[model samples]
Target: MFDWNDIRFFLELCRKGRLTEVAKALKVDHTTVSRRILSLEKQLDAKLFESTTRGYVLTQAGERLLPHAEAMESASATIQDHVGGENRNLTGVVRLGVPEGFGSQFLSKDMPSFQALHPEIELEFVANDRFVSLSKREADLSITLERPRSGRLISKKLTDYSLRLYASRDYLAKHPPIKTVEDLKDHNFISYIDELVPDPQMLYLSEFVASPNVTLKSSSIVFQFQATVAGAGISIMHCFVADEHPDLVCLLPEEIEVNRTFWLNTPEDIHDLARIKAVTQFLTELVDRQKKKLLGVLE
Candidate 1:
């Protein structure tokens, strides 16, 4: 008979790609993950991973076990949802990965309300633009600019937004007149400070700007916007974020525009928890309510 715990550990290892990464996701120690993997491999009598400094690579047996484990995950979720009866007051944590822009511009302001209404639930908002692997349980929910790779997950197009290049009104005053995209080459650029480029929006630079000379690199869009507003440099920001900030003005009104989509992503097993279901429903509703606000960001 197969030990269910072994399967669970194997599933986690396959999804996460490394004992270290899995340990961090499970909030346990690397040694624990290593022990679990070794135990599972020993029981199955198969090599499941090829360890390296970067991470673990799944072996053939590990790959073969993936679909079965995912099916089990789906089954588990279904059973839980059935037993929970779709209750609204869900207790437990719902880890949320939000782009820094949305976290600051919209979600943060309304989060208190979500907390007040659902006191039993704790919201873990991990601010990152990088698309963390949902299959690995990096987060329970994620809001991203582009659609993620399809798998055992449920996703929705939350909203369509845009990015507009802008600078502090005072900085614009100092900069040359912006009439075309070519003019932007002369100005200092502010960009998200990481090489982990999963965001399709950032990839636009590859096609548009042949050589981008970023003056400031920040991990947070809010901070990037702040720096731009303080005359640090010019940046392309979600129009909604730049619109209300009184200090910034759109540069080259017609040249710098991005048509982007906001997608809400979650694991397929999300429906199993009553609390997750409530947040999922509320999140869908929340995005629907602000359709215009998101659409206005790029225009």
Candidate 2:
């Protein structure tokens, strides 16, 4: 039987199309790579490669076995990446992406605790409404409301949150009471400017107001809530976040409701790393603890 490790070295050489390049990328001596290829041919009783002026050319036997060898290499590498990171202490920078609203309300409060637990690990947060591409390493992990469409990343649904209309108590009293979605049309509304985003709640709000009537527009949900509190107008916000401020009151306690989801995403192939595993587990636990606040937002 052919040695699979030897087959891997052969496959790498084929992929790189040069012995020196493979050696450099793999951080091995060039001779070591050459020796592995030679050893592979002898074990298989096959002339697998020809040394050419350009580099190594695959023989007929090598060409036949190339696909199988590459597949094996991929499978083995995936297994190793996961098992290899086990029992390793997590250290280094972990890039995390979050929505500005969540970053300010939830994550910011727990960062000191998360850092305290893993003091060796450094956190880098990028807060925005735009989704970052995990395929490009824009972030190691992301907290998002949308279940990512990219097949290159894995998403775990953490929780669903409800957004309820809120306004300053004074504003609610001065303006006509909003008992139904249609009542919002008579009153000014504040929301994110983009009328194109496919928000389930936003779609339902169309019955109440024209899409363009978003007089006060901002991408940040925190800013939207701040506008509402300052009597700028009525806006929908996550109940957990809204409840945090005593000044804002739910505009229509029973009628104003839109459910939103939260997701945790990581690179699809990162299931094996020790640091990634620890961070993922910690985040899962952290969100689970707030299940009540996240899921049950009333009043």
Model 1: per-residue lDDT, tens digit, 173-237?
Answer: 88787777777778888877556555645655445565877878866677887889899888888
Name every residue pair that clashes in candidate 2.
82-272
Clashes, model 1: 3
Instruction: After the best TM-score superposition of candidate 2, give how far the Cα of residue 91 lies from its true spot, in angstroms.
Output: 0.9
**Worst ten in a row by lDDT for model 2:** 196-205
Model 2, 23-118: lDDT tens per residue? Answer: 996789999998888888788888888888988888899889876775575467566655666665656667888877777888788888887888
- TM-scores, all candidates, are 0.78, 0.66
Q: How does model 1 fare in lDDT?
A: 0.76
